[model samples]
Target: MNGMWTFLALMMMISAQLQAQFDRSPWSFGLLGGMQRTHFTGTFQSLPGLYNCCKGFDGSSTSMDPFFGGSIRYAITASFGLDMQVEYVQSRGELSAVNTIGNALSFNGSGFDIVEAQSAFMMSWTIPSLGFTPSLAWKPFESGFGIRGGFTLRLQSNGEATGREELIQPKGVVFSDTKSTIRNDRKVNFTPTSLVYGPIIGLCYDMKLSESFTLTPEISYMHILNQLIEFSNSDESLSMSALRAGIMLSYTAFTPARLVEIPITPLPIIEIDTNKPYIPKRLKAKLAAFSVNEQSKEENIVNIVIEEYSSLTMTPLLNFVFFEEGEDKIPARYARLDATDTPMFDIDFIHTPNHVETYLHILNIIGKRMIEKPASIITLTGCNADIQKEKGDMALSMRRAESVKAYLEKVWNVSSNRITIKNRNLPEKHANTQTIMGAQENRRVEITSNEPYIISPIITLDTVRTMNPPIVRFRPQVETDSVSTWQLIAGQQDKELRRFTGEEKVPAFIDWHIGEEMSEGLATDSAIVYAFKARTSLQDSAEIQGMIPIEQVTLHKKKINRVQDREVNTFSLVLFDVRSSEITEGNAQIIEFIKGFVKPNSNISITGFTDRLGDADANQRLAQERADATAKALQVKNKAIVLGKGNSALYDERYPEGRLYTRTVDVIVDTRIDN
Candidate 1:
């Protein structure tokens, strides 16, 4: 029993390591259990009372009991493999014999009474043990029928014994005879407790339950190779063996030790067979929550500013509300003057919450998409329906363009180089110019640009037998005349592994793996599959697969490129005098540099550092004061930001040469992205 427990502990450790090794192999594991017939064979030295029990026995006995176990099997090839398992079994055996004993006795005063010993006797033994089995298995021609040959290593056993003895005796006076069965009970704490080994042979059949699940039935016999038990002070030796048969069930799947998941948008695939006619699909390519009714002519009356800088068109999601804001109560910022010298109607830029929300929505989509494709550029061209009395139409249009550009640069962190403001200063050339709708239609900004930005619909499938080849089918909403061509591409890392193309507008029942020519884009180890549809020059990424489940991946390539542009400014740091918030050197140089390099929309941040010779709090204050002084020095300070770091500079007075560099200000600058 102790040896069994020790073997169990070792099995746990081995199982963990084997789990990784067999994860990719076509293998199965099962819980094993069965019943076995076991027996002990040997002779015991004669003892005071039990001498006849052993020496007088002329026959041997065997007992049937139940045993349980677990097993793991791995195939080195299609027909040959290894099976390892641990089992526990307990066996009980009994020896019984019938004998007759009688003797003539001298008489008492009257007559002699006779008794006969004609009864039964029984002696039993129980042995419990843990066994480890390692076998070599063969499954001919990839069939389920298999044969295994191995050895069972038996551990020390938990032993016990019990017995019963009975006889007939005389209990009557002379000339009277009566008989009764006299019995004696026997019990002993003994067992066949020693290291033992035996040969094992078995036959089994594997029945599959699912793609990765299976059940196996087997029967095995064990023949002992050595004596299993010996007495300490008596000349007794005992050995044992067994036979077991049972079923085992197992799964060859991932039993996760730890799990992580990420939500992703799956790109949709359009199955296109150029062989079929093109039809409109239920492709709602409108802005969020709004659909386009082509029959109507600009029903919402949104300002449409067309610019040549970027290629994203603003998807307007408003009713005619912008064309309906009360011109009489226009905010001072959005207000324009008239002949009465009063504010007149114009699309509110900042006053109303609803208008701001719409503005922000458009900006967010445009901004985020632009950031994704940095090569794209955006131009804001402003327009007016009529000239204002206070400021000419050109000035008002320029102001609107500037306001829109500032919002993007400040709130969205759009780079200045990527954005341009072009003032049209012209009224709506379309009919609504004399009406309110025309005014709103003429006052707007246009965005014109395009991965990794998740939208909706993720694709995934459970693991399948890679050996048998798998298929993926999807039900797509293919509205007639909407989608032109659908594209499917599967890839790993950053490379395009495979691509499947179709022009058919019918519902797609496409192969997950197209032929090499069609799937030329896929490099295919394991990767995310993306689906796209072509519309003009731009492609819409409609869906993405979380993972591609492939069996027996011989080579896996993980190429990760983390490109972080770490840039350093060549200009020298500004040095400061002791205990002063004044620029001691390079004041003129910094001013000149700011004038040359910093754009009007650019943001400047000056952080001040100090020597560790003063109170920490006071030094922090001094550093801030010094930064403020430097900000004041710059000719352009409208967007300059400042801070202090006390003694937490890159250099400190911890070493002999650090103090000189501590009292300085480091200028770190970046564009404004208001959170």
Candidate 2:
């Protein structure tokens, strides 16, 4: 025992020394040897006809046995393994009778003496067996401590039993021997069970002894489930339990280590001059030329020809007012009248020489005409785009018509019965449905009058003006290494007329139309001034200002020439679809109207324009194609000046409507009236 304790201490020291280097192997083989203490339970009986001292013995006994085994292990994972052990075990047991007999013995020589003697029976057995334990092993922590659980199968060889009688009291009386062997070694009456099975549980600790060897100390307990011995004469059986302690020396097969190589590259070095100073590139801008109609003449004067006329009549106002999608109210651009304001609303006071302005007051015009001619009736038909949010929405269409009717009834005092309101999915003369502009044009209210004159165009005697070289072109030159953005703002003095802005680089040329910019009112007859500004990404800026002279005609000179009345009419045909020069039905009608005003002595100007899309050269060709198509459709006899302006936006290109309006052909007809 002392040597055993010393060996355990030495193993503990070795385990501590090798703990860090310990690595469990996937396959291991080992040999194990141990001492086991077996506990015998139940009953042990004597042979049926051979017992001399007693019949049987009951209760339990404990004895020491020897067990030697070899194990093979397979690791399923880092912390779990399967172990199978085959062991040869020798088992032994002893049992004594609980009750002792006290008998009287008689001596013949004395003829009347009596002696009391007490005796007991003892029984013992031995079993030599081979045990197979297949178990699951688990190492729960990083340390070597582990636990194992499984069942054991034991196959027993033949076993032997013996019985003895022992004297308990009166040892020195008549009998001299205190103990006596009543039964010698004999085979058990019944054969020991051939096969035995039971459950076993164990604990172990692994101690590394070398690079490939591990020493494990383990303890286990097995409960025998079957009888070891059975008696034929009685209902007697025997069982045993083993508590075992052992050590295993195992050899672990290890795999060899491998090495990998990697390549390295060197970086290039850069040199710098210490005394040099760094300077950023500079930005530059120049107002190259602010001229009219790209003209290079020194006197860039825009001629404003104010023509006097005795009477001028605008015939046939457009009958449709367009609306936005999914809307029931009239657009704000249309002129509206209140009940109080209607009494003072005179047709002459509201009439404008501009056709677009006159068209905006169509509702008021219809209402005023209805008030004048009470018998005249008109119909208002509301239409929708018939797609997307407005698809099949008859109620919304009706509401839109009602909105128009309500305006005429409330403001103009036109009787509701005199005005008929109707709704439809789309206008009879619908534009291209696939395009956005076409869809927008379809959402409108159409007006028709019973009397032709009621909805006819407004006629007024007024003076009109035209600009010579109508377009004022500006060219700016910017020089920079990193100029981010630039802007050109044109105005008369302080009021900005038009502002053009762009990024990266400024365009080669920018144009401003005099008639269009001065539509509100001519601010000055002297000169038009503009400012050009440019900026870099670094916030550096450059600015310049320039002015263009204006040639103005006085109003008195127009009165003197009033006898020679001149009529000027302008019309625009809007192209909605991109890269399309085909004249739509509506545009064809507009061209017919233009042809009606054309005469042998008429001065006609037709200019075609494209939106800011596609390459400049392509747009130029497209504009020319549109102009040629319009000219051919008109079939005018007189000579006409036609031009194609490429990608020069006449309207703001940022909005869809503005871009749609830019793709157009403009025709202006100036006729001299013989007095």
User: Which stretches of candidate 2 lie above 4 Å from their native place?
Assistant: 1-296, 299-316, 323-325, 346-359, 431-439, 454-461, 466-567, 572-597, 608-634, 643-665, 671-675
Q: Which regions of candidate 1 are displaced past 4 Å?
A: 1-27, 39-42, 45-55, 99-116, 168-182, 231-237, 254-675
Q: Model 1 compared with the native: what TM-score?
A: 0.31
lDDT of 1 by residue, 595-636 (tens): 454555556677777766659999999989877877777644
In terms of lDDT, the poorest run of 10 residues in model 1 is: 304-313
Least accurate 10 contiguous residues by lDDT in model 2 = 176-185
- lDDT for model 1 comes to 0.53
Q: Name the best candidate (by lDDT).
A: 2
What TM-score goes with each of the models?
0.31, 0.40
C-alpha lDDT (0 to 100) for residue 541 of candidate 2: 89
